[model samples]
Target: MAATAAVAVACGAPAEEPAPEAPHGYVAGAEETAEVQSRLVVADAAGAVRVLDLATEEVVEAGRVDGVGSVTGDGRHAYLASDDGSVRIVDSGSWTVDHGDHTHYYRAAVREVGSVPGADPVAVHADQAVTALALADGTVALLDRARLDEGAVVELATIPRTPHRGPAVPYEGHVLASVAEPGQQFGSGVAVHDRAGAPVATIDEPCPALEGAAVTRRGVVFGCADGALLVSGSDGAFAGEKIPYPQAVTADERVREFRHRPGSALLTARAGEAGIWALDVTARTWTRHDTGPVAAVNSAGAGTALLTLTADGVLHALDPASGAELAATPLLTAPVAPGVRIEVDTSRAYVNDPAAGVIHEIDYADALRVARTFDLGGTPSRMVETGR
Candidate 1:
């Protein structure tokens, strides 16, 4: 049976008098300068890209784009991709249409591409104008960022049957994707693609049904179905380790969701359990954090983690090292489950609550509070932050 909890805060308390509307979106932290401006761009399931100023907690500008499969940004521009095989570029400064400026806005589309049912756009390279994996059609395609208007999205290459439902990570000019097959049964691996879109190598020995993967400045880390973790050095050397699956945790107790800490370790939440596990790759150890049946988990940075409890729509901030709660704030009211996805940066977090048809925002620095929410018009399946 599902658990129940009491709601503590009123649902509609008028927000502390709204801050001045930001120029781009919502600005959260300190004053915005040429170098340090609070900016975030998110893509919803309905194929729209919304830019927010983290400082002001407001939507700066929103526009329709074809299948915004994923999003990423440098410090100045946000890159968006579509599962239908297209890419849209938006200027972070003005939050307006700049598709004509290839240097700033690069657009591309793939024709006759079948559906990528459970995939998302994971990585982007602004300098090279290349966008990486996350497609449900069991393939990963890399397209040209410059001549996107050529009508035909040039397919640099494709990776097949990679069931990874997480973001693709780009490291040292190459893109890495996790491949896990359905039923959590077998045949999972990691596919490494070069800049030219060629599969250079595939690592399948350690685990299959690999659900999450992240690349750091030094190597790549991935999580498997049966509580296994794998790491590959920057030089392509592979290492495998297993995380103890709590005996008290049943088969129904699966790793509900997880996030990789770029260069450190992995944070995972198990269903039916009221805690999050921090797996240290180097030490080959697991430290469990009691947080109550987490609906979601996201790593904002090295030592900071976010835990979402679906029952009351509350999000908790944790210090992975000490298993201590740093802050807590309530978000959505509806029950969020497996399909609800979240993405975060150091200052803010974004959640795609399909049932609510809106993307909820949480301010990490401010008591892990829910600052604002936006309607997506349809069930949003995934979310990612781009351009800082």
Candidate 2:
């Protein structure tokens, strides 16, 4: 953890100086004091996870896991799903491994039993059980969180062969999953499962490949190929509304990622030529904001979104409701050649420059200003904030 430093220049300085270049590696103790503290966890391309303190702008802790995938947090514990068939847990408070030995803090080993090839863990249910899909073997398995340290995950249930990638949202009491063929133009479907992990219903329609899925307070929203969006209710009934993209948009122009702002009625993302689109489920309308080639998008509190540009490494905070630019800051002075991934909380944002193996902290309250930076030993792929 590094302490903050205030750079000074004479008011009557004769010449203007260029901003300092971002340092590389783990530069410790550079902390920032802000009104609110937000945590950002980021994974670099090399599959390592780093936990950052947004308010202090410091790299509190760092850990490496193989094949890191999706990250989810309950505002207390940060869960990292790995492709090595395990889930790693971290106490967000101390930025240390959760379980024990700091090494095996929160680890659950899930073996591929019954001839089914192992799949990367996707979504964690509301109750914390994890859902994973075996694409090659066409199997879906649910693992209980309580039995994580027993060297084997307690298998909850399984679904037969289906082509789908899932964060399978667990809504009300049922878990939802999707199935779609990559090359197929249409004809995809979703499945609903009871709390016991038994299939209750299946929905098949002309949906594109599922890109992102989220369970909102109101309903379930799933992103599809060809800019098709679907919403379902808690009763496993369709909402009778399909949000179709503009006629100019094609299947090739599909949404890659989505993040639902807590307590918001809108979902924001980087969509095709439409750039950052704000889809209002309540209003049943879509508004696009022109953000040039968005490299990453993250939630910035309720009804707000953070968009990052790959070319310049500039971050823009937007109002999800009106698509307005709330604040902007330059995280990286130069272009992040390999690109960077961002993780945001209501109070702060963390930017990972993998090329430099450094994590930059930006203070959201100060209009996304660079608060501090950290250098880590290994490249980070994803990050989450766990409050211990």
Candidate 1 structure quality by residue, lDDT tens digits, 181-266: 56443336666667675677765555545555544333455556566555454564444445555445544454534564223354
lDDT of 2 by residue, 1-388 (tens): 1222223334445687898876532123322222233456666567655666544555544455566666666443455667766656553442222222322112111122121135545555444345343233345566554343222345677765354454465655666666556554222657777756678877655455666665554566777765545656555554424677654555545665665544345666776554666667676666666665677776654444545554566778776666578888766646564435565655555677666667777776677778777776566545555432
Evaluated against the true structure, the overall lDDT of model 1 is 0.54
Question: Which residue ranges in model 1 land beyond 4 Å of their true spot?
Answer: 1-36, 43-48, 55-62, 65-130, 145-153, 160-169, 175-187, 202-204, 235-252, 260-274, 281-284, 302-306, 318-327, 336-342, 350-366, 369-382
Q: Please give the distance, in angstroms, between residue 168's alpha carbon in candidate 1 and its true position after superposition.
A: 5.7
Tell how far residue 268 is off in model 2, in angstroms. 1.9
| RMSD each, Å | 18.8, 18.0
Best TM-score among the predictions, by candidate number: 2
Per-candidate clash tally: 22, 27
